[model samples]
Target: MKSNPNFLFPKLASTIEELRQLSISEERKKVLRPLVLYIQRCVQESKTCNLNFICTHNSRRSQFGQIWAKVASEYFGISANCFSGGMEVTAFNERAVESLKRSGFKISSKGKGNPIYAVSFSENSDPIVCFSKLYDDRVNHVENFAAVMTCDHAEENCPFIPGAEVRIPLHYKDPKEFDGTDLEEKKYDERSMQIASEMFHVFSEAEKQG
Candidate 1:
């Protein structure tokens, strides 16, 4: 990992600046504390943090968690690898993709049914490869990684992840409920920004620990 990740594209940087202004509730901060400590441990040990964000479908909230966590790690100059997965395979939701684009992410995708998206926040950093698969997919770290459950369903269904060093429940509300409605874009953007803000908080706390 780059010691100091490259500067984000101007638009993305602006979006992140906006996210930084959002306030996280104390209750929510309590829920996020475990993740903060997990990253702090990695920082203290000089270990590369591997985060696997898991949800039921691996389409919406989980993807946001994966993307924002990676961005936050980079912003804080933390060595981290972020991944997202689900209990069942599905395509990354298009609405979520559009919301990310609105936030200034540069994405290119290929394949038919389940296109793989290459998502980038900075010009020099390699794009994060995103698609839907199980949490234990070969592409993800096999052990010594944090299994961050991003949805209630995944946390309930997956009681044990064989290789995970810690399982943290950092659940997020699904924006999929607003799909096909006038509020679709609004809700997706809200959830995406919410996740982005929270991830930034987590990394910021970890950086403070260092």
Candidate 2:
């Protein structure tokens, strides 16, 4: 990975440390380590790595993966691109946006009828481009990218991704089950934070190796 003189290593390290304090399953740690190491290899080789996080609804887990990947890439001084899509077309959920905002992401909504939300990692960084679309449509022409399955349904249903060099399954539980309860928002926020924290931890380890 190319080194940046302005890279904020201390801040990134602290962020990862804080995130690691949150709970993560042992099963998840196993999958996350290899996946992150793969990303580190791609970055080290100076390959233009493109990542697609897939799910059934393209609303929750996949979205979180996409955002966290982008943020982690920036944090590690890696140049990588991240995208997310689902098997079915669905608008971005408001709860997801709110959860990200609560976790230090800046989100701006524009357009109409479930408009695409522009998400930025930090105030000065370029915003990550986000929209609701099917996985195939989103990655129709892209080749040589990593396809990460963030939901079990998507991973099982779509066995083959035409252009993906590496296919990794990183399933996450849907927080939607807790919707409409007193813990609805809290659950969503917790889910978002969990994804963010784990991703941060994984990338921080990769950075250390470099």
Candidate 3:
């Protein structure tokens, strides 16, 4: 792993390569490829491609999106910053952290009572940290970045994001539906794998262009 101060954490080269082999949806692949390439070009040119993944809870889908984007960008030799936030005030859910860990993401617990566990893809990458804040908490703060809505609710409700240069809707189903069930872990893992697979496919397409 190599570190980049301008970016949050260093890129995890190996993991990104590994993820490129995972299986995912064709529809997702179709959209993610060109989008990722555009993002990568922006970052490589020293432009800040600030990506904000937003969901209703910001516990699972958006969190996964944020982490995978960071890992994918690093693997493809792209420079970009990634963050995750929720439409409502909610801490990073423990199940999501556990799921990511199981998927081989190197994570660390930073604050008391787990404090949402600051997650990073590799030692050099900055942890996917979050504040228990709302999407609109600091109106003008994230104005120049891309506003990516990762769930249906957030995408529909947040039609207008202040200061956002581009608004993209990338929706995923809530894996929380399996919470408390006997197969909860399996379901989370499945969801995580799906996300990982899609991200890899996106970057693989980007790699082909060069």
Q: Which candidate achieves the best lDDT against the true structure?
A: 1
Candidate 3 residues lying further than 4 Å off, grouped into runs, are: 1-18, 40-46, 110-116, 136-141
Q: After superposing candidate 2, which stretches have Cα over 4 Å from the reference?
A: 1-17, 23-26, 138-141
Tens digit of per-residue lDDT, candidate 3, span 88-159: 777677888888776666677666542656666656556666544566556214667778788889988878
For lDDT, candidate 2 versus 3, the one ahead is 2
Quote model 1's TM-score. Answer: 0.97
Identify the runs in model 1 with alpha carbons over 4 angstroms from their true place. Answer: 1-6
For model 3, give the 10-residue run with minimal summed lDDT. Answer: 1-10
Write candidate 2's Cα lDDT for 1-210 as tens digits.
443324333444455457768877788788887777777787678775678888998888888888887787786777678888888888888788888776666679888765889886655678876777787774433777788898889999998887888888888889989878999888997788788888776777777774
User: Which residue pairs clash in candidate 2?
Assistant: none
lDDT digits (tens) for residues 119-174 of candidate 1: 98998899999998888899988899999999999998889998899999998889
The lDDT for every candidate, in the order shown, is 0.92, 0.77, 0.68
Candidate 1 residue-wise lDDT at 79: 90
Give me the overall lDDT of model 1. Answer: 0.92
